[model samples]
Target: MDKCFYRRGKVSLSGTIVAVGIFMLIAVRGMGQTGNNSVYRLTIAEAIEFSKSQNKWVQTANMEVNAADEDRKDVIRAKLPIVNVNGSYQRFSGLTLFTDGLSHATTGERKPTPNSAALGIDALFNIYGGGRQHALEEEQHLRVNLARLNAQDQSGNIALQTATQYLNLVKLNDLEKFLADQLNRARFRLNNINALYRNQKVTRSDVLRAEVNLSNVELSLEQNENDIAIANQHLDVLLNVPDSVIIIPADSAGMTKPEVSSLLQLTQSAEVSSYTVQKAATSVDVQTAKLRSIRSANLPNVSFYAAYGLNYPNYLFFPPVNQAYSVGFVGLKAQYGISSLYHNKSKIAAGKIRVKEAAMQREAYADNVRLDVRSHYVKYVEALRRIEVNEHSVEQAEVNYRIINNKYLNQLALLTDLLDADNLYQESRFNLIKAQTDALSIYYHIRYASGNL
Candidate 1:
């Protein structure tokens, strides 16, 4: 019975260990799958979304916007009534008292304790500040708006970057496919040439030429793959993803060309819609408000204040010793700095100059935006034209390649001629892909320049 029990316990222990091992294996595999599943299959829109959420620059700009909002709130809160509570404790080495003639004769000596404590609550309400407060409030509001516009501009820039990278990845992917196909064709040709050489139908030099062609095609394929890897790294940086994470572009077909607006229309829209222009305009308003705020310094400020407190050794009209008593008062006050009348002229002039400078800066920025819009619009149009031309070139090259290939097989054309035709066809295809991607990228860029993206 003891042996049987021991044997059963051993069997149970082995079974438990195996079960645990299997569970651990499954858990590890599940973790691996979770990591692998992190790969992103993103379209341009999705990439933009991820960039807005993850890109460090965009996040920094967003923080600036939040800081501006808080500044505005601080300015507004400063305009409201201010309230505070304060307390103090003190212990003096000695207290001094003056004795009247009668008290000096009646009591020859006097002693005092030195401990004291006091607490108070006070409130102040601004009645007027010569419109300085209002001007400051307006200035803060404009600053907040400026910050928001800056963040919007940053977001547009990030979107443009994501779109550009995404488009380039698609182009590289297409190029890689092209190079792969070319490599395969080279391999096939080399095999055929080798067979022909063995059967005495082709010379050894022809086989050597085919082998050299295959090696060059292989080298091109490797270079194309390196380009793809670099492009992927750039995109990964933009998306804030791990460099090892593969990002497969879901929309390999590329973006459609946006409708081309006339230069006049694009420029007109950019003038009003561009974030850069709007930010510059807001800056002008802020500077103007600052000038108004500076001018208000010449006027007197009015306020009302009240306080309630307890004190030891009351020092009011009635004499009380070592007793706590409540005291309260309310009053209105006005203050004017007479020196401001003499000292503020230069400051006001400087403020005015700053305002003028801001306005001029705004005009300059608007002009630049117009030029940018026009430049991108022209590029997009030119790209479209190139795409049309490349399309026909690809067709002709394909036909030429077919004719040359047939001649090569029939021993009527040199291997070099066939290889040249194949290269032309491939080059035409690559040019078409490049032009199409360029047109799409430029279209998005135009929208970004117009502040529409």
Candidate 2:
């Protein structure tokens, strides 16, 4: 029996999918196609997967993470040994001079040499640089964490948005069902009034009123269809699909309201892992590294340098005195900046200020997250209450509608009363569905806020 029921549900869902697909094709084709395209459909889960793969925001977020990863690697590489090929050639059309180191050479005459050149491969390894390289590496490491957090945040946001849109579609479907049932009831009343009028038991006004009510129900149905179409288009845009693509959301009625009373706990937990918090924390680390870098600015930078090269004189590609000669020398290089008293002071001051600012912002963020948790918790409870109240109201409205409808059929109730009851019932049903949607949405938001997203 369960299998049969499941099969029936599948058939019903398939029919709905086909209808939406046809509408989508018409919309995309500009009404030129006479409904000849095969229908394609996606469930809420499938749609979310598609969005993650094709959505522009997801792609852009991933790109940012990739770029940060590359940047971090680049910074680390800066601390590694560097190798470069060096070459130089000089030509003197007029004259070049060469002098002995000990005042004179050979003939003791200071004479002009034609030209000279030098070329070599040089390598430099940083032995120490007041921890500048280390500071930069640490900063980049924090940046890598910041990038990952940002990507995670973006992913979570997408999940929330997709859940909201999917729920909205489900709500629309529920609302349409409510309106359909009301329209059916209205048509039934109109038939009764028409029969009464024919038998001279009711006035023409009574029959006309029933007709008007039925027409109004039909108009409401048309309006609802338009709303659903617009909603589907919006979902398609978010998913990066063609606007005409039909999406079929699964039944969401079974879902319960999110437990948001524990929002404070969740928020506290989530804030500890939140992307914004992580980014801020990383900012502090980065700024601290900057301070270290600034403080090290006054310290001497030590490096090991070595070079071996071939020198050519006068662009001849070889030294005039020697051909294919290689020489290598290793030396310790150190640089001290005495002018740092004025030149580096500003940077040190800026680094300190940034570190302090990050600390303050981190504290502010913690407070804001607590407030947000409290606010959303209230919304969550209110939505849950709405669901409960609307649920009961819809039941009462349905019963009232049935009672009024029966009286109208028995010539005991006015047409307006029947119409009013039917409208009330339908409205109650819509509100119930909306409340349910909100309850579920708020729960997920609370979960997201608490860091479970």
Candidate 3:
């Protein structure tokens, strides 16, 4: 009866422990879900969109474009006709306006206190210029375009960086899993060696060696786990998420070798609209406009103006009695400055030099863009080949590991041989992962270089 009671008590304790564990697990899961609710889940496309819309640098570039647009419109409107309304009212103790033989004057004007108010609109429109207005407008337009392209370039860079961090995190997770497996295998081997040593079937040295290997594997696993945590932190920083939040990435099993596209086509596209080339093209336009403006310094500008007003010596309330007069005139105004030494010669010479510099910059830009496209294309091709080679290597390493492990278990292989095979397997796995990730990154880069990004 006592034995039965003891068994019952032990079973009851086990059940209670399990119940507590289940409750804790449930609570932890609930907390995780709640935390996840506040975190944003991002897809690749979503990341790109967020960079374009919300990244600080990209948003600043966008605002710059907007400001440039406003400035351009202001410049254009400045060249157009503008109107102003004028109104005034005043009271004076004494006022005078000379007329005829006697000076007509208001003296001691105390009747309802004198007041005057008038309202009129006048406009000034640019009739002719040295194309300075056009040059300024063109400059603003180029600036806006450059700002837009700059934003696009920034978006591409951010997206690439985010993707890189995400892939690194994935690789770290895989490394953690690999380390965990190795640790478990080491532990099992250590237990078996211990049993053999106790039975005098294995040498004491073998048991000691197994224990050392187990310790090493444990340390490695711990380090890998720490690496994974650090990788997660980096990913969080890139996404602007809370560092404590968990990010479960989508499946990464589909990594494959990237294929190379036509280099000529990519280069051609880059020549037209790649970020670097586009910026250079915009600069040329800006500089050209500036040069034209400098040349316009020698030309004259003409404007027209008109104004009308009413004056009275007393306050004019509602439709009170008032003296109203209208005046209009049309005239063309022009001004030119003559300089002897440096005005015309230096400005024109400077503009020519600027034009030459812009041309040289354009040439350099074209060459650099072509080189960039070609280089990235080569990298993409090389990564493709590396991926293929690494994939085969991984397969061979896995087979070698299995064979060596079986041989070691059967006493046909030395422990060192097995360890060597294991090392090869791990190295191959790492190379495969690196090659695949690199290929994907290179593909994205190719797109970016080709202006698709």
| Cα-based TM-score, every candidate | 0.84, 0.81, 0.78
lDDT of 3 by residue, 1-453 (tens): 111011111112354355345434544654575564433343444344333344455556667778888988888888878788877765656545556757564445544446655666777777667888889998988888888777677766666676677677667777777777777777887777677678776678777777887788788888877876787776665544467755554436244333354445666677776787788778888888988888786778777766664545324455444555555555666766556235777877887888788878878988887888788788878887887799899899999999998887767877778778877888888888877777667666766776666
Better model by TM-score: candidate 1 vs candidate 3: 1
- Give each model's whole-structure lDDT: 0.79, 0.71, 0.68
The top-ranked prediction according to lDDT is: 1
User: In model 1, which runs have C-alpha deviations exceeding 4 angstroms?
Assistant: 1-36, 89-117, 199-201, 253-255, 262-267, 318-324
Span of ten consecutive residues with least summed lDDT in model 3: 1-10
The local distance difference test score of model 3 is 0.68
Residues 1-453, model 1: lDDT tens digits = 111011101112354355345434544554565565545566676666556556678768878888999999999999888999999887766434556854553322222336677889999999999999999999999988888788778877887898899989999899889998898888888888888889898899999989898899889888888988898899888866678867777676344555565334655799878889999899999999999999999999999999999776555534436667788899999999999998999999999999999999999998998888888777888998999899999999999999999898889999999999999999999999999998878876776787766
TM-score of 1: 0.84
Kindly provide the TM-score of model 3 when superposed on the true structure, using C-alpha atoms: 0.78
**Ordering by TM-score:** 1, 2, 3
Model 3: number of backbone collisions: 4
Q: Looking at candidate 3, what is the lDDT of residue 304?
A: 77
Model 2 scores a TM of: 0.81
How far off is residue 353 in model 2, in Å? 1.6
